[model samples]
Structures are given as C-alpha cells and as structure tokens.
Target: MKTRNLIYRYLAIISIALGANFANAQSFPDRPITLVVPNPPGGLVDTSARLLSEPLTRVIGQPIIVDNKPGASGNVAYQFVAKAKPDGYTLLISYSGYHVGNPSLMDKLPWDPVKDFSPVALLTVSTNVIAVHPSVPVNNLKELIAYAKANPGKLNYASQGNGSVSHIGTEIFKQNTGIDLVHVPYKGSGPAIQDVLAGQVQLFITTPPSVMQHVQSGKLKGLAVTGKSRHPGMPNVPTTAEAGLPSFQLESWVALYAPAGTPAPVIAKLTESVKKSLALPEVKERSDAAGVELRYLTPTAMDALLKKELPYWDKAIKSANIKLD
Candidate 1:
C-alpha cells in the first residue's frame, strides 16, 4: 500500500512538471525580447539583425528590440548574453567571428563559445567573392593568379579589418598558392572598396553584398567566388573550384542563440518562430538583397556546423597568425 501511494505521488509530480513546461512555452515572451547584436550600427550584421526583428516579432507575438553591443571583436555582446540569466529574454546574434573564428584568435575567451549558449537558428551565410578593380589586366581567376605571380609584391589586396572574414580567407589563398601580395586592412569594406575602385588596391576578397553592385556596374570585376557552387545572384562568377582555386574556400554565417540553461521548450518556441520568420517572403527578399543566403539551419545542424568550423578556422588563423587591433 505504501509503494502504491508513493507511485501515485511521483506520477502526480511528473504531470505537474510537464504541465508547467507547456504553460511556460505558451507564455514565453511575457515581456519584450532583446536581440543582442555584436556589431555597431549600420553594418551588415546590424542591418540583418534589424531585418529579422520585424518578422520574428510578428511570429513570436511580441516586440523584439535589437540591442547593439559591438566591441572587443564581438566579445562585448557575447559576454553579455553568456552572463545573462538564461531566461530566454536575452539572445545573442552570433556570427562567424565570435562563434567560429574567435577560437583561432583568442587564447582565453570569457565564455566557452560552444557551451555558453544554445543554438536557435541560422540567419545568413555570406558567400565571399574575389573582385578586382576594372583597371586590372586579368579577367578571370586563372589569369589573375598568373598576373599576381608575375607581379609579386606589386598586387595588393584589401580586407574589412584584421582577423576578419576577408583577412583570413585571403591569407589562406596566399598560403595555398604561394603568392606574395600585400594585405591592406581597412576600417571597413566601404573604404577598402573605395581604394580598390580608385585603382589603389588591386584585389579584394569581400562579401558579395558589399561588392556585388560595384561588380554589376562594371566598376569592379568579378573574378571568382569562394563557394562550392556559383551564386545565383552573380551567376557569371565561377566557384573557387571552377576558377582553379579549390583550396581557397571560405564563407561566413550568422545564427541566433540564447544563453545556456534556458528551458528547452522556450528554445523550441524561439526556433519555431525563427523557422517561420525565415520562410516569410519579405524576410527572404531582404536577406537576398543583403547578399545573405538564408538557410534556416536548425539548432542541431547549427551546433554541428559550429563544431566543424571552429577547428577549421583555428588552424587557419593560427597558421596565418592573424591579430586583430
């Protein structure tokens, strides 16, 4: 009789616990949700975050305010989310630099990039392009490589900043091909592309969105893309493999994350909202316009990608000895 009574009590407790979880998930965002961006205002990352906010807010039935916490190479925002109460109120807008590339650059980070957060959904994947000014004598990647080899130190390349997507990618290209070109780090892509357009910088490996308009307008020449397949937006540009530089492939991506220890059901609700937001026509259009390919990768897939990319970038950044200012 005592055992029977104990079993009944245990079952009741389990039922109540499950009910609370269901209620919690249903009642999520009882208040405003903050999406923390690790970029300053007006950058691509910040712009993408704001674009996502509208659709996500509608799907989640709450106000989603974007918080820009840019500094320390994304550490400022990352640390903020890491230490936040894991109550689903705070979320981090994770990108390649903090999630994937920082492991290679920083010796000791405040939080374990892998453990400090729960992956929600992937937002964007940026395909990088190798573009040159119109004045360059090369039309394709092959001729460009030949010309760069012949010119040696005469060819210079531009990157957004040190330890950035462009910096690490271009360095890998030089490492694989044994090319000796100068790296000119700019405050951002605008200045870098300006120099390239003015015939001051000969080459630039940048995100398609930043340089695509210039490429389309004939101000910048598209040589090749650092993707496995050609991008539809720029169908004329060949893939790295097609351009005979298979070893030089690099892409940057962004995702949504919540602090670790958040309730699983809360994560599930946010994930569902994200999937729905990504499916919306406006979100798709905005992402494409920003030159971001929306993959809507699930949490599990994003976790797997994080694990895979960490080691790859670690090796590349270590070998390149990339130091950010």
Candidate 2:
C-alpha cells in the first residue's frame, strides 16, 4: 500500500508540472521579449529583426527588443540562444552561415543546428553578387574567370570569415572555374566590404544588401548575381548561369529560431506572425529596397529546406576540398 501510494504521488507531481508548463506556454509573451540577432546591428539580420519587432510586439501585447551579439561567424550568438531557457521569451534571428554551413565546414560545432533549436520561420533570401574593384579589368563572369586564370594568385577575394558562406561560395567558384585566387578572411562582412571598397581586396562574392549601394554608386563593378533569376534591385545583372556557370547559385538567408523544446503552440503563433509580416506591403517594399526578397516558409517547409541544403553544402565542401583547421 505504501509503494502504490508513492507511485501515485510521483505521477500526480509530473502531471501537475506538465500542465503548468503548458499553461505558461499558452500565456507566452506576458512581458517583453528579446530577439537576439547573431550579427552586427546594421546588417540584414538586424534589419529584419527590427522590421518584425513593431508588428509582433503589437500582436503579443509586449515590446520586442533586439540584441546584437556578433562573433564567431555567428557561433557566439548561436550558442547563447541554444543555452537559453526553452521558453518563447528569447528567440534567435539566424543566418544560413551560422545554422547549416558552419557545421559542415568546421570539425566540431558547439551546437547542433537542428537539435539545439526549433524552427520558427525562414524569413527572407538575399542573393549575393560577384563584384570587383573597378581596377580588375573584368566586365563579366567569363572575362573574370579568364582574368583570374591568367593572373593566377595575383587576385585575392575577401570573405566575412573562414567557414562563412561567402568563403565557401568563393571556394566552390574557384573549383568550378579552375582558377586559383588567394582567399582573404575578414572578421565580418562589414570589414570585408570596407577593404574591398578601399581596394585592399580585389574581389568579393557577397550579399547584395551589403554591397548594393556601392554597386549603385559605381564604387564596385557588378559582375554576376548568384541567383536563379534577376533581382528587382539589379535587374540588368546577369545570373551566374547566364554568365556561363550553371552551378553557382547562392543566397544569404535569414530565419527565426528558438531553443529546442519550445511548445508547439508557441511555434505555431510565431510562424503565423512571420507569414503575416512577410505579406505586408510595407515589409515587402522595404525588404526589396534593401535588396532582399520577402519570402516566408512554414516550419515544416523550412525544415525540409535545411535538410536539402545540408547535403548540398557537404558535397560542395568535399568537391572544393575545403577543410578548416
């Protein structure tokens, strides 16, 4: 009788704890929330976070604050979000470089992209453009390849860091084109662009948002964009395929993620908000103006995307023979 009573008491305690957790999830955002962006304050990820803050705060009846924690090719912020309580109050604004590609490039990543976080939404995809300093003497992708081959190690390309998507993409480009350009890694895209503009670096395969203004102002010569089709911001820019490389399509994407084990109801609510935000005309226009395409994906859709892209990157890494020490 004593053992049976003890078992009943343990079950009762477990049931009560679960019920309270569910209740807390249901009443999520009872206070202000924080959206931690894993990049600098002025980048695309931070801009997207600010875009969602106002409307989401209105819907949740709480202020949404953005915190920028940029480092480690975004591993610093990724780990911070991973270790956060499995509550909906703290969310992560993620990038593909941080979540998917980093794991494949590095020997050991501190957090498992899929297992450590729950997908909230895949928000937007901004294509990268291959731009060079005006002195490179290359007008198009084919010409650039010929120039690179002729010049050999005379040209150096800058990426945000080692293991970044920019770096990986550039490596893949080198393999595809059979060119050997030196790789220069910067602390972040901001510095990389700065050096590229100052002509300290001669080439860069980087996102349009970071380099669009320079392209518009004729500071950097646009070669080709890494997308399937034309972008609204640079309609005349040819894609890599159109420029003779069919296998070079890349996009700088941003997504929202929460610590794993966050409640299903909370995820649903967040996904709905994302869809709604993407559909807004203001958001679409603003994002487009910034060279970003406003795209929304359900959590399931995003999960499938992650799965597909992981193998693709793995193959690219192997093909390029890229190994980070």
Candidate 3:
C-alpha cells in the first residue's frame, strides 16, 4: 500500500508539472525578453541584435533588451545565455564562429552549442572579404598566395580571434594554397581592421561591410570576397571561387538560440517572431544596407546546418592543430 501510494504521488506531481509547463509555454513572454549578443558594441553582432530588437519586440508584444557580453572570444556571453532559465525570457544571438566553429577550434568550451541551446533561428549571412594593405605587392588571391609562399612567414594576417571566420578562413586558405603567413588575432573586428588599415597587418580577411569604405578609397586592396559569388557591396571584388580558391570560402552567419530545455511551444512562438521580423520592409532595407543577406531558416534546418558545419570545421582545425584556452 505504501509503495503504491508513493507511485501515485510521483505520477501526480509529474502530471502537474507538465500541465504547468504547457500553460507557461502558451502564455510565454508575459514580461520582457533578453537577447544576449556575444560581441562588443559597434560590431556586426551587436548591430544585428539592435536591428532585430524593435521588430521582435513588436511581434512578441514585449520589450526586447539586447545585452552585450563580449569576452573569452564569445564564451562569456554564450555561456551566460546557455545557463539562463529555459523560460523563453532569455535568448542568444549565436554567431557561427563560436556557436558552431568553436567546437572544432577550441580545446574546450564553456557550453556545448548543439546540446545546451535550442536552435531558434538561422538569421543572416555576410560574405567575408579578403583585403590587403596597399603597400603589399599583391593584387589578387593568386598573387597573394605567390607572395606568401615566396615571403613565407613574413606576411601577417589579421583576424577577430583564434576561431573566428577570418582566422578559420585564412587558415583554410593557407592549407589549400600551401602558403605560410603569421596570424595576428584581435579581440574584435574593429581593432583588427584598424591595425590592417594602419599597415600593421598585411592581410585582413573580414566582411566587406567592415572594409568597404577603405577598399573603395584605395587605403586597402580588396583581393577577394569569400562568397560563392561577388558581394553587392564590393561588386568589383571577385569571389574566392573566382579568385582561384574555390575550397577556401566562408560566410559569417548569425542565428538565434534559447536554452536547451525551453518549451517547444515557446520556441515555436519565438521562431514565428523571427520570421515576421525578417519579413518587415524596414528590416530588409537595413540589413541590405549593412551588407547582410537576410535569410531565415527554420529551427530544424538551423539544427541541420549546425551539424553539417561541425565536421568540416573539425577537419580544418585538426589539420591546422588550432587550439584556444
């Protein structure tokens, strides 16, 4: 009798908890929502978050606060959101570099991108541009490779960090072309681009939006864009494929994530909000002006992408023997 009573109580408690969770999911976001951006202010990640905030807020009928926590090469912020309560109140704007690529590049991670977070949406993609200081004698990707091989480690490339798209893409370039160049890692793209412009670094592989003005002004030499095709912002720059490096192309991407256990209904609601926000005309215009391609992927598709990207990056990182503390 005592055992049966205990079982009955346990089942009743589980039933009640399920009911409460379902109810909460249905009425989710009664209060404000926090979107944690994993980069410093003034960069693309922060800008993307700020742009999406108002539209998402309006769609969800709640105020969306963007919190910037830029450190540990994106670990500080991503881990923060990963540990937050899975209550639909906290979300993360996960960059492709740290969210997916870090697993391969870093020796350890504060949180598992695939396991600790629910993929809410795959937001946008920005093609990375490869540019050089004008003083360098390289006019294009082929010339850069020849120069790098002839000069060996004399040339240095600037990247956001050890595992950033700039770094990974550059590393992949070196691997494919068999060139040797030193890597100079920065905390963010802003500082990195500054050093590149000042000629402190010879090569900078970053997004066109960050270097479009300098490229146009001839302060920096735009060698190639990393998309499969040329970027609209830098139409004059050929793509890596066209620049004779088809295997060495990468595009920086952004995505939305919630804590792993966030309720399904709440995730659905948040995904819906993302779709709605992306559909807004003003949002489209702003994203285009920012040199971002606004592409929204469903949660399932986002998850699939994460899975697909992991192994390719893993192979590259392993080949390069790259590691971050």
User: Top TM-score: which candidate number?
Assistant: 3
Of 1 and 2, the candidate ahead on lDDT is 1
**Model 2 — which ten-residue stretch has the worst lDDT?**
316-325
Each candidate structure's TM-score, on Cα atoms with residue i matched to residue i, is: 0.90, 0.88, 0.91
Model 2 TM-score (2 dp): 0.88
The digit string of per-residue lDDT tens for model 1 on 9-77 reads 999999998897678767897989999999998756787788789998999989999999988889999
Off by over 4 Å in 3: 105-108, 198-200
Off by over 4 Å in 1: 1-23
lDDT tens digits, residue span 139-194, model 3: 98899988888999999999887777888888888888999989999976889989
Q: Candidate 3, overall lDDT?
A: 0.88
**Model 2: CA > 4 A from native:** 1-7, 194-200, 217-219, 315-325
Clashes of 1: 0
Candidate 3 C-alpha error for residue 253, in Å: 1.4
Across 1-325, the per-residue lDDT of candidate 2 in tens digits comes to: 9999999999999999899888987887688888999888787788888877877777667888999998877789999999999888899999887677887877778999889999989887878899999989989999999998998999999998777789898987887889999999987788899999999899999988778888888999989999877777777789999989987788878989999999888888788877876777777777776667777888998889888888888888877776664
Candidate ordering by lDDT (highest first): 3, 1, 2
Residue 281 miss distance in model 2 (angstroms): 1.7
Order the candidates by TM-score, highest first: 3, 1, 2
